[model samples]
Target: MGNQPMIVMSEDSQRTSGDDAQSMNITAGKAVAEAARTTLGPKGMDKMLVGSSGNVVVTNDGVTILQEMEIEHPAANMIVEVAQTQEEEVSDGTTSAVVVGGDLLGQAEDLLDQDVHATSIEQGYRQASEEAKAILEEQAIDVGADDTELLEQIAATAMTGKGAENAKGRLAELVVDAVTSVADDAGVDTDNIKIETVVGGAIEDSELVDGVVVDKDRVSDAMPYFVEDANVAVIDDALEVAETEIDTEVNVTDPDQLEEFLDREQEQLRAMVDDIVDAGADVVFAEDGIDDMAQQFLADAGILAVRRTKSSDAAQIARATGAQVVGNVGDIEADDLGFAGTVSQQSVGGSQQLVVEDVEDASSVTLLLRGGTEHVVDEVERAIGDSLGVVRITLEDGKALPGGGAPETNLALELRDFADSVGGREQLAVEAFADALESIPRTLAENGGLDPIDSLVDLRSQHDAGQSSAGLDAYSGDVIDMETEGVVEPLRVKTQAIDSATEAAVMLLRIDDVIAAGDLKGGQIDGDDGGDDGGPPAGAGGPGGMGGMGGMGGGMGGMM
Candidate 1:
């Protein structure tokens, strides 16, 4: 009955299981949330992220911050995906979604500490998320494409905390005009609305063009700068003679043969120009290089030409001018030509740009954004992107809800009631989920320099009295109805945020094991000699290293 010796087997891979794994994942999730929670509402601050190459990006947008960071933790990456999904679906509310997801995990950790099963927490969160979605649908207000005023409000709501907040009113109007101008029976076609930004002018000087804007000016000074009632042709191919597919020698032994070859090439180029002129076109957009001879022919025929136009710009021009882009010049005809009321080359913001304006029944348009600096222009572009996205969402979904965390507070209130009806340990998880929903308004108040506890208390009182639309007034630090105050967002944003945040939190809760392969190629963790640096183990720095609730709560409290 005596064993020679006791032997144990071990694997090379580093594995973290049970409570240790859950703690690590939750800590990582909360760290990600803590990073973005500071940038939550209208009063949120911006982050200046400097890259390894010294490139700098200053933004409060959640997706930009997460994308720029080099996050290594797998659980943290999942949180980043939540923000990405929010941005993709609603184009705004990314920060809120991520923060809420982090809070959900934080709350689940508390329940786990109380010995609650992970499955019960997951089930409770799923039920709570469904209830939240239903609540958002019930709280939504109707919107339509024809309602420009409402659309402007939506844009302003998105741009409130962005760098362009000062000029949000003007930019919102321009965004609304551009989206409505390009809207079709299918809905708003945002691609058809091009945005061109140039640094120098004030933000107030930005304007919307009823037609397209090409960055390229006239190809030659001899070309006409302005053509009225222009007949435009979009050529997707080169205006020069087609090149031979394979290498060849012309074998021109005499000057006469050389002259004939040169003249033949010129004739070919001239014939291409002649085809356009015969088609009754006064302006041409060539997607590839236009030979010098062709330009001379076009100019001599009183036609304006732009060469090497970007494919996107060319498609936009065709849309604005009602032209069909022809792959071959020989296929072009008068009927294939497009029309524009005026095609002119002008000096705009110290740059030469081709302006195609005053087109009748034009379905495509452009917005020229002006600013005093490169950073300003970049921020303006981001702000306008969000604005346009919300406008499109409102047009397509035809519904919206009050912003400033009103819907979230209402969900918290209703979820608490729902939690009371459930009689089990799962009820504790449901109650935790309700408390997690309050992080939004609490964050908004915290970011706005108000006492989160005081603000949340007042908000709860207001929502409990049947005033569900009541939300925090970040500016004044008062409880007020966001809907009545003109602070609103697309309904899809709220529903998607709740759905994505809950899904991420639930998925993370079910992860109880983490296995990491040793880096043999790096020769650090899996050394041949088994050399140890007396350092912590591979997974030691994970949740085991995380300071408990007090430490994390202190970190989060500092954000307020």
Candidate 2:
């Protein structure tokens, strides 16, 4: 008895179990979801995030806002991953996915409060998710890659809420053209579809380039401004004279010998240009530097040359021009050269860019994106990216669905009927899932400044009457047939959103315990040590500074 001693736990290791942990997790997850919810739909409001450095971001992009937040809680980080996965998979619908995830947790929390088992709620959600996928597949409309009008509608749908909304028509045309030009029977490779942004002109000036554009200038002013029907040579080797691999010293004491040495180097450089000229190459894209003498010779020979081109751009040019990248100048043959109608230098946005245009049988293409400012340019890029992703997914799956919350309303109305057949404590969860799904349209209505309940009630009534395509029109604050209105989204986007959100929510709901190690520098939880570097703003959380330590009040603010 005397040798037995009591053990004490250190405060550094903190643990929360049962209801406390679940409540904290639910609250955190919901906060993250609410952070992005307001940014959903066409009429969604933009968030003005001001960083500690006074840098401001005014955006409605879910991924961007989530990424900009500073979240530290582990549970909240998991919720952030849902948004990131949505972005990675579809490049759109991030906000909707997060909102649905939050709503699911909110519903589950209510079920937990009612003494319903977490396992039952999770099972119900999983079942509803599977059912949602089936509904999406059954209701989806078929689309082909060649359907230009529908593709434009898809593109315009993606850009409706953002900065590119004003120029969506012109931008959609450019996106479709660029995507189709680079697409073959196999599939669309977005890598071949490059978006080059220049912040100077209006979005209307944005156009598609048949070939690649590199932000590079010609090697010398003496070179021709433009080369037509040019024989393009892509040299990976340097134009400078090669030095001996083994280090050696040439001690030339005689003046004539030194002059001979200098002349030999000049001749070597000149010979390199001679070799390129002999290959019948009229344009040179050197992956490495071109010597001064070689540049002069190429200019005198009327060969347009760009030195030190990026390796990726070099390969892109090769693909577009049907040229081979030559490692040695001596081995460059006529067949190694590529053909391009014009290779010219143009000044864009106060910088020189080498424009390689009108290549025969080109496989690669570029979208020259121009906008009024940097912010507009960034937002425009995001819009085009979303369009490309949507188009690619639609082409691959050959399916699309009506947008403007029609799919959500349809899923909700159908889920309730399915819930009746479920018939268990799980049925409550299914019904809850149905209710959760309606939050999308409700939030959309609210963001559009309409009465959310009224809009949702009207939507539910329409869907009940067999109006499958009925959806909230944010612009007019009325429910309309999305299909007739030309509002559509990729089936993959909807299905993926449901799967990702449900999976994340289920994972969060199953957790009933949390153990965290307190700060090593101090004994407090999340407390700053005296050595705080002030790297990121103190208020910012990891992904979304949505958690303000305000407990319930802060969480509610995030939802609104």
Candidate 3:
């Protein structure tokens, strides 16, 4: 009895404790970071992720890359959440957030090896994160909504490493215009700015429409192709005869009775079309289907009709035209109709599209992105989306910072100085946090094909000399003024990235044990009761379960 081992848990359960668990989790975090490291900065390379279904997505966007990856480690997924949070809050800087998070864990790993307590590291990181945000606030430059030139630079900075780089200048102008056009006193709602991509033309052919653009075409070719000074009616209801809710049979023995039933159906549809005509609507955008009979009546009335428009598109059109979306067409009135300068059907990239443009004071607009191929268009769309996000943030927050890793380099220098104020072992953690931030500029230099050490040294020297805006110029590998180079990003992008990265790093640092329960039928663990089902061995950490930290390295390797 004295020599017997006590077993309280299931035989199929696996547990990893102490230093082994910490090391495995840290390694996982670093691996996830390393995967996105090369895809940072303006010279950053893009990643082509191939899924199990053989679907390929080629992009440098941090959130997109992490989301597309099939990560199994729970700790690694936490790092992915950092990127997702950044994307959700700022719409840009996902790569920076993820890279910083990974580097923070890497720095913490070095501290852990030095016998420093994880609690001290976590506390130090919290202090550094708060100080880093303060430094960002002090260094942020004021940007107003009317600063169109500066705003364009912000958009261009976001598009630099993306597929739209060659034509970023023109696209930046379009993005700024689109954003500013839709901005109201309540703040900018990005949803009001829609992006529509058309394949088969150079990216430079992209243009900003003053109003909404629907992918749908006119219901009938007989309908007017164009309407000037158009009035639009947006309806959510179908233009077909209403059917009874319950199933019932209509018994019609007489020919007259059958003829009356058909006549009534036509009249109901005609009335639906008449509602638009009576409301003086030159264009109709329907959320539901438009019956063939109703289409003929609409076409005869010289009204441009688009049927089965996506609800989102219909809502945007309504916002652009200042019209209210009515559920019942018969309830429409003249005031309920929206006004547009022109409603026309055009062939874009060999596809028929309805364009509503030149609406006065439009609250919704579209950017018609053109590209040479489907992949090109997709990449361009992604770039434009990022640009729009940053620009919108700048407009709403009214604060921005210089890019090219300027903010990070400055924060590192500032945090190191602040670490002195935060004494004790926690100060070491703060200093480590600072060092982790330098990775941003180092990776930027490396991606730009420059000497990382020399680039980092130059940036540190500049920041120490009170030149806070100094950062690596990826093109020349020189430490120059990012603001002078027109490299600017929304202040929220930097602040949010630091906050999210720090929180994720701290959360991962506090973990020291992992326990995974195995299933006998699934054969996740090696035991006498386990079935012969083919699954990764108990040590392999199959899928979402962390098996014994044995599969940690392999899980991280899969991400790479």
Candidate 4:
């Protein structure tokens, strides 16, 4: 009953029976819950979680909070799973998951007082959660299959807080059309398209074209002869080299002296022209005006040079090309090509065309715009992101099931029916599980604190009457309650908490040995607390507060 090591057992190292592990789980689950309690609703405040090293995470999101809490307890880790599962089930309901899981533990604790066994509670709780999940899935709102409404909703919402609402919509339409067009084209690669925007241009200047835009002319008149494989260069500094390594005052006596200086300049220019020619760069973009001598030298080298090109254009060219030609000469390589193909310049609003021909494949891209203003664009992006995340989650876990609480709900109802048919502890528990699933809507209604019950009831009635999207509700009452509209929540969090708590409490009651706290890593209880020197400790609960207490509330307030 004593002399056990106090090392915490890693979950992988432990194989304790499910019933034997519950005692420690109860506290851990609650500890996880505490981490997310503050951020629950639109009115919910964000928590500035600071880690030991001072990294700060500021968010009102439930999942983020729980995830941020550095928890070390095994039982507390389970709550994270519950939230993760809920998040997977429904994109924006992580808070509901943790809250419900915590409450379920709380309720289960009461059950433990009434002598329920750990196994009994585990089976019952899981059964109830599964049934509840099935029920919610049945009532989920379905956007019409062939309807463009969802698409429009996504685009429109993406621009909501974005500025230039009308402009944003127009841009989104253009983007959608462009992407759809690319998709329909046989020769085009849908994934290859990109949208590159430059902010210095005016709003009227923001037009889309088939190819890349480079705001420069040919580097020099003698640039390449229609390069089939172009190598573009962007020189940020003056291509001319500095006078000499040593600084000296020059004394020019006459025009002949000036001519001598000029000759030296031409030599430097000739060297630059030779490098470009040898490097096989089809185009050279320079930021400053090219001297007549330099221009003439480039012409002899058969290289096209564009002088006075905007520095930004030069940068884009450098990025597009693998060649480097800064202050002096540098080698160009075949691997410098970032894009597989380039587009030839078709003058669009004064911007020069970047002609790229011959690629292994094609690419397509569409940029949805919310507004011209930065803030509006940000909000719109956030909304669209929410929808994307939601879609991803649904596709991953919740496949389309038979409609309208028809199969699963009916099956759940029948389980309850069968309990009436076959009487047993499990039978009763299974039936109760079905009822618990049904309670999700009820809790939603209560949270809404409105006639959501009536609205939800009507929705079900409407479904019975052949109404579509019946799972969606018009504002029934409180903002949170309106979640019944299309929120499709899982089982209430409180119920999960109650279940886990009871399971833990019952498991703890069966402990007898005072093995060193080694098993406590996962789920542990004081078997027989031996006081120091081989005597029994007066208190049996061991030292308190060893539970891991991290938390997260998956993000909340996401749109669409």
Candidate 5:
């Protein structure tokens, strides 16, 4: 027989379960946080994550990274949720949240080595978390009107790219002002606001216009270029022209036949156009159909118009402007539309747009967007949306607390004290939570590349000296004191988040060897399939999660 090389492979698969789960969770949480920890401050760098599908994303945003990752481990997903919760609660502490969560595991690991039971550690963690939050609040720096400049600095911190620094700074101010403007004793209108743009593409003048610019010509010949005390009408629902279909059969290509058909169509269109203009509609947004002849007639009648509009947009305009769509131009009435005392028309970039003031009230503000390229405008729009939608909501809900890592540092100490107060297994979990909370300022210091020990010492000293801005000792760290306003979470939300996260961690950590310890441990097979549970589970968390559950008793299995 010819000589052949023998190959050997390990026969036993290393089943990561029980304590392995907790350990893995600690590892993954730390890994994910370390991946983004460097991008904490303004000088923080970006990460380029190339997905299996060849998709590329370069960002240090914790939420984005968690979302983009095709995470397989259940414990890693927990880390992602922690980041999400932090972002939701504070809008600016996601990186800190995750890093601290990892740190808690690290500390817990040490405690475990000392032979501390999982139950005891959990109990301690709970107590510590409570203490930490209290400390954070008490030690927080007051950011009053004097710190307005700091707000700008913080906004700049969030911005990137070419105009990011400048735009973000100005935008931060605008955000404060806009928020303040709409905020009565009640609050800002966080849900409803509008932004629009128009381009003069087809006209001789190619340029940019701001503030609800539209590219259509004004309708009618007799209307004033600037109609002061003009009533406004927004037509969104129906064209209200002729419901009757133009079903007539005309076989003749002759000029006379064509003329007859055209005349009938023109008459029908004119009737509809005339109705709206006569109804005192100085402005019209037609969501549906409108013929060229009818538009020309309205122009002749001096009516401002936008043709072929999106129905949703048209409806909003009507709601905002208090206008209606008349069935025919001849049937217009004054009361159906909104009253705008001052109506101004401007033609920029070959586009004609009407600015209506005092439509329903004077508080309405529209941001006019102008750009030389579509990409610029698009990016600007996205930036504005992100700020308004995600960032603003987060701030509004979190009470817009101040920045500078003060609250975090204070909270950490409080957690340490709280853990000391609690007893039993619950204390272990609480201690973990508290330890995680305290890690924020340290991470910030680390990210800033500051001498953490010195910075922390200075921070404590500043607090003792009543510097008003000092909390933890990171005052001397290379970090900016943006707006450190008092941002408080509603008790309900705060409780829910903490409860859900801690519960998930504990419950998941309780399993040992999923197959060996599960109900189907004794070679229990499905009626049809040979696999346990009749199938090999589905989605991300199946038997895989249960396998790690064994770590619960040891405080390591749940780490998955």
Candidate 6:
């Protein structure tokens, strides 16, 4: 084997090592970051992603855009994961996290070119990340549960430039109310707050319901359209007549026998209705279907019944009304019933919906969001979701920070000072980490049509002047105090973004080689074929079908 290249791997396998591997990974990560950079601030633009099936999603939510892109590059996918993790952890700052992660890789590339070891850069980044989180924690302002104004500001900030800016004020108030209504000493559970979007009215028409709104109608038109002082019964089982599980045949010797059999079925249905009436339940939400006979019985009893309700809706109603879900109709009793001040069937967007409202000691609430069109409603829903998340996080953590890129600028300034204290090659890496964090404010300025360099300079000067809350106002191209501007975000958003972005960056930096094995054809591996293959498919592992490591420079160009 003297000087001969060993062919232990398949001939079709491709390998990228040294600087080439690092460059390819960095390029992919940057592309992923750029895909979300434009959707950052109050003046940021929206992305209209058209799926292969012609489905279009119009919004600036970073996680939504990344998830819809269906990215195939392994490195790019890692950046997307950073956004996803941020979204799951804080429900906001996904765009900021992805952008920061991409910029960190970009900054590390400069160090690599200067012959800095990958381990040194990774160590420096880890150190900077921990310190950055500490700075954010120290800078956060304490928020109390009674601070309604501050909570609204946090919600409104999350909604800015995400397609609900036009009605953020009203939406923010509703978000705060919905979140606080369900909050307890333990913490706030966002899942208790449901959002129902209807396309037919202006965004300002959105309102908060004290209880729950389910997208279901009365099982029978004969039932009362509305019931006041309602005792609600939530049923997980069907109201229909039960049949024997085993196959059985009954021989009827006379017509009277068949008539008696049919009469028995009617009696069974009436018995079910009687159980509900006996329980003093004026409203019924059934997870399974209600028989026609049961519907007629309920209607005659002046009871409102909604059938085929989703299990989630049923559970929410049970929580809202303080009612228990009964599995058997016969088992329903007054003790198992939940009370609602009113249960009504209202027509919304030309569709009927059951609204259960005004429950005492309610634990669940709903936001009825209205928009003029389907697409508009969809974007509004996304905006409202983010707002709810931030508000819930703020209430839970009881700490928030000024928004509008204020936290990033402050973190950058502090990290630079920290770099000066540590005099070594790692110091250069720490300073580079500081520069990468400045990308947030820079991207915000660029997306708002302001000069990034000028905006960044102004931000640094403001920080140096001891005004840590000062940040760029994207709409006015001015640096103002974010807290005074009513721009605030949960402290978790900033810290989580820093932690996730830095982890992703350090993980990518530690990589020095990439080996891909597949049946390479025309310099591209087939992503569709994976059966007893030597390695994973193109998109599954490595950069096989993504035009190879060197050819992936332009792979994410069409993401937006």
Query: How many residue pairs clash per model?
Result: 0, 8, 0, 68, 84, 0
lDDT of 1 by residue, 93-145 (tens): 89999999999999999999999999999988988888778878987999987
True lDDT of residue 507, candidate 4: 42
Q: Please, what is the TM-score per model?
A: 0.88, 0.86, 0.90, 0.47, 0.65, 0.89
Better structure of 1 and 6 per TM-score: 6
Best by lDDT: 6
Summarize candidate 5's per-residue lDDT along 376-484 as a digit string, tens digits. 4544444444344333443344323444555555455455456566665555556566556545566667666676666666655554454434433233454333334
lDDT agreement with native, every candidate: 0.84, 0.83, 0.84, 0.45, 0.50, 0.85
Q: Candidate 6, after superposition: displacement of residue 320 in Å?
A: 0.5
lDDT of 1: 0.84
Candidate 3 accuracy as TM-score = 0.90
TM-score of candidate 1 against the unseen true structure: 0.88
- Put down candidate 3 lDDT per residue, 124-170, tens digits, no spaces: 99989988888888879999988999999999999999899999999
Over 361-442, each residue of candidate 2 has an lDDT whose tens digit, in order, gives 5677888899889888988898899988887887788898999889999999899999989968999999999999898899
- What is the Cα-based lDDT of residue 74 in candidate 2? 71
Q: By TM-score, is 1 or 5 better?
A: 1
| C-alpha root-mean-square deviation, each candidate | 5.6, 5.2, 4.6, 12.0, 10.9, 4.8
Q: Pairs clashing in candidate 2?
A: 69-543, 69-544, 70-540, 70-541, 70-542, 71-541, 71-542, 71-543
- Whole-model lDDT, model 3: 0.84
Clash pairs for candidate 6: none
Q: Between prediction 1 and prediction 5, which has the larger lDDT?
A: 1
The ten-residue window of minimal lDDT in model 1 covers 520-529
